[model samples]
Target: MAKSERDHQKVEAAKAVVYIYINHLAYHISPETAVLYFYQLMWDRLTPECLPVRDALTVVIEDEQFKEEQGLQFINRSYYSICNPWHLDNKKRPYLKQIIDRLDREPETESINRTTQALREQWMNFSKGEYGDCLRRQMHLGGHEIFREEDREFRNVLADYLPDYFYLYRSVTRTPDIEQLEQEHSHPEYSGTATKQINRLRESYDAVYEYRNLRQQGVTGIDHPSRLELAEFEKGLDFYYPGRNDSFKSKARTICHKKRRYEKYASYRPQVKEYLMESVELFPARTKSKLTESIDRALVRFDDRTSMDPITSKSLFLGLLDSVLLPVPNTSNILRLERCVGDVGPMNFTGMLLSLVLACPMIRFRLEKKLGYLYRKFEGKSLEGIQWVVDLFEHINLALVMNARKIGYFSLTEPLPDAA
Candidate 1:
């Protein structure tokens, strides 16, 4: 066969795979699970050879081809694509970013659009049958209901001990079996410490159950004593077990110290705002307005900075760059940074810094200056005392070093001008 024919055959096979996958997803799982899970399933199935096909499918799905043809809407489609777990691996970042960049550059010109449209139409027609109707009904009921029967049986077995079981399960220590606890507490060998611990657990369980019951009975404003009960139980543990409570006390002290530091730090936000305003001139003319606007917005949103922890505070600052500087052009690329940093918890500060450099190359020095000041204040502090600040310092240093290396490489490898 000719090379062109072979290539055509490959394309046709990919389309078949995509069409089968989409139909299976739309009919079986899409409505039952969250869109993120659907994306996860797709990512798991997409091998290197299938990546181009996946990209094509992304365009088709995001462009609302299925919705337009079948009147089926996909909620949070952009989030599912951008925050797809597959994108988290650094190795996959460049490939996914390239696809995203190309899509942004030419969204209207997907070569496979016609093929995708035909596949979608076929899916819609096939899904209009009785079998499809049954699948749709099941999807509408959702996965939760499917497992509810099993859950109910399990819950019934622990009806009286649900609160205790839940508290133990959520605790840092090993969870004791409810049945075993009943049996062991009755045993003659049960020690005083074990008895006390079990009693404390029961007290906590009662307090929580009572609180929840009152809430269910429309008793709002009733103070919940579960936390206080648990704290007392923890205190008992400290009293009974030497050195067992030291870690807890140290953690509590650190939290209290952090709270004090944050209160002091918050007082300097006005100064930080003024500093940022002055540094706006450091940004290019095109980005200066947006950068200033972003600063103002962040200040307004996080006026009560003391309410947030150090990690949260840093994330909010990075979120400003994510919103203002990153010209990701489309929802998909927007998700790239959001999934990386947004509400997902503490990201690698280095990655955050690199992304900022990529988005706003001119702001690197300004970021360095601001972050350096913050770092110096916490430099000699204990790891627990300044972990967030340390992360910020790493972000700045990595960004600067990476940017410098790039610049150095370009300067050394500058090509000679071609002879006219």
Candidate 2:
């Protein structure tokens, strides 16, 4: 099949999976928890550049303070019987059988360290060679993994910022066109502190996105970036700006051009420090009038803003997002699992915080390392109380996918061509 046809099929498959969970499986478990499992399965099935055995062994012996224990467990117990490949009589495990067959074809040899290196070499070669095509297809068509069957309550007092499952499921079934999907990713049901802040962020990011596009199209004078220039450029566009004043034009120029001005005055900089402050301020009011006052106490480490990159800034943003519910500011260790509880519970609050973070186009994929850190930290814990963290991870996964759609990597909304 053509690549576009294959892509269409892949997306259709994903949508079907979403439909099954929302309509059937969700009747038994929390839809939020199921999304967590969806992301876990996708990661387990898709990312095996080297030997699965090697990865499992690495996690077991990994010196990294924050290793994801569930990574190995989820793959072994769910994907296939990788632990005992020779006992592969099960037709359900074709993927496992293929891996063993590949190993069988390798030259007969054995060594303590050399054998280990050989398996690594074999997987590397296999993943980069023609077999790689099969791997991608197999990933999408892989057998179902076990799902957590019980519904769980959140540990903290989290407000319900998510749409009802019925509405969310209905929305998924009626997947909109790519254009509409991009424009209305936010749901009306979500109007928590984080949601409101994210909406503000979306406005700022939209302007930045437009400014970047205009510059790339060879719009002159914006190369140096000034509101005066952007205002003149805007006059030609279809968008209406009620106040076409100098400061409004100048503010646009600042946001698009001052990408790395994180200093003492960084708090006032557009789309950088200022955006961070606005998002952070959405935290519930506590003793100091702003709950973020505690969070910013930890920002002292980031004082040397001169060397800070977008990743660091993103880390800071998500850290504060995670800490929004904290009784005290401990941004040093975000997602403070032990202290994640509130009267309403942590699930909805964290989910809302994550939704807001994903609204900003700039930080969409810029903070993967931070996310991986949180996943590792939360892995192996009971899903009964902390399912929210898993739910949070899935939100990140959805955010990343939407980011890809925005950039046109693939499409779920492509209409089938007219039949011949």
Candidate 3:
């Protein structure tokens, strides 16, 4: 008979795997390591009951006295770095009229960690099918040793998902990208204060998102970020995961040589921060998750919204012209087509509407702005050539309404009610 591995043995191995995996590949450090470092750094900074092992995930375990004694080693620089507008220096961020910029670039995915079985199980239970996960989601249950292996895997996978982790604290990464919310927030109780702080961070993270989207989408008629600013935003995303070495390549490099008139900023950035923040702010506060239970409830509401509405489910596909269809973006027509519809469609109507959409410069600009597409002056000739698609759509929908009326689409009465 085979002997059983003690639970402690499994945990130790899992811990070693997590540490080594992150060190060799994931870069920076794993959250498991973060937990340990936090314990040592904070030293008695947290009351025993307030420890994160329970439900409290984000209360900073800062040793105030140690911070004073050991100087900057104890500083929680990562927490503050969340606001890129602030200086990288540790101390205080100036409370001036800080401009919150929008980030649209996606993160470098090459070295990011993958989900482990343990984390998948915990997350599945924690999220309760609220926020759908792409990976590590399939393996949610297992035996003792298997559970340990899963935990180690979770450490690996979970580390890569830092942006989503930020959402747990901040209430931003609500699942089911729906037009309307149907549930509340579901912040994990890794720790109370830590969880609360995550919520706060989620708010700030989300606020920056709203500011950028509203500006780009022209939802509020605000000025969109300039091309140079877009380049800078791309550069600013590097800090999300520690020791990230990926690059978002610069158009700045090209422009600088061509004109030699622009100032070039350094480095590439992670784009997740900007995208989710914008999406999170669109919800009403009642539907939004800012507090504990409020957020938990908000997740339920959000899940419902993300659920595709059978009555009016938006088709997700891109259409090519019947005249000439090509996957590559080669012409102004092709670029405009991608810009106007992205990956949304039902095929038949997608091609029809996109051609018209690109026909209107206003709609084109709106789609570009909403998607937060960086507008390169060298690329976009002008927001001019296409500008009348809006009237056409209005005419189309209006005609549809008229036809519906003629066909008696409305049914207001089953029968006439008797009046006294």
Best by lDDT: 1
In model 1, what is the error at residue 21, expressed in angstroms? 12
lDDT (tens digit, per residue) of candidate 2 on 1-420 = 898676555544543443343223223444344334433322222222324433443332222221233222222222221212212222424433344234234443343453343434434444344233222222211121211122223333211212111112112111123213324645322212122223323333344446656766888654322122344334322121212353222333444355453433244223444534543344445422343454565355464434445666555555554445332334544545334334223333433443334333344332433443443344345555655554454333333322333322222344322211
lDDT of 3 by residue, 155-274 (tens): 332222222222122222211221021123232232222333333333333444454446456575443221124433323222111123421112212222332112111110112112
Cα-lDDT of candidate 2: 0.35
lDDT of 1 by residue, 1-420 (tens): 998677555544544555555444433443334233343433232334346556655444444344552223221222223322222233333333332232222122223456444434433443453223222221111122222443223422212122222112111111123223334557422222223333333344345446545766888767654222344423322332212344322332333344433464466456545534543454445455655676677666555645555555455456555454333345454344233333222223333344344333344433533332332333335555433433333333322322332212122333422210
Q: Tell me which of candidates 1 and 2 scores higher on TM-score.
A: 2
Give the Å shift of residue 352 in candidate 1: 12
Model 3, CA-based lDDT:
0.26
TM-scores vs. true structure, each candidate: 0.22, 0.32, 0.17
Candidate 3 displacement at residue 217 in angstroms? 21
RMSD of each: 25.6, 19.8, 25.0
Better of 1 and 2 by lDDT: 1
lDDT of each: 0.37, 0.35, 0.26
lDDT of 1 at 186: 73
Clashes of each: 0, 12, 48
Off by over 4 Å in 2: 1-97, 100-264, 267-274, 277-282, 286-291, 294-335, 341-366, 373-382, 394-420
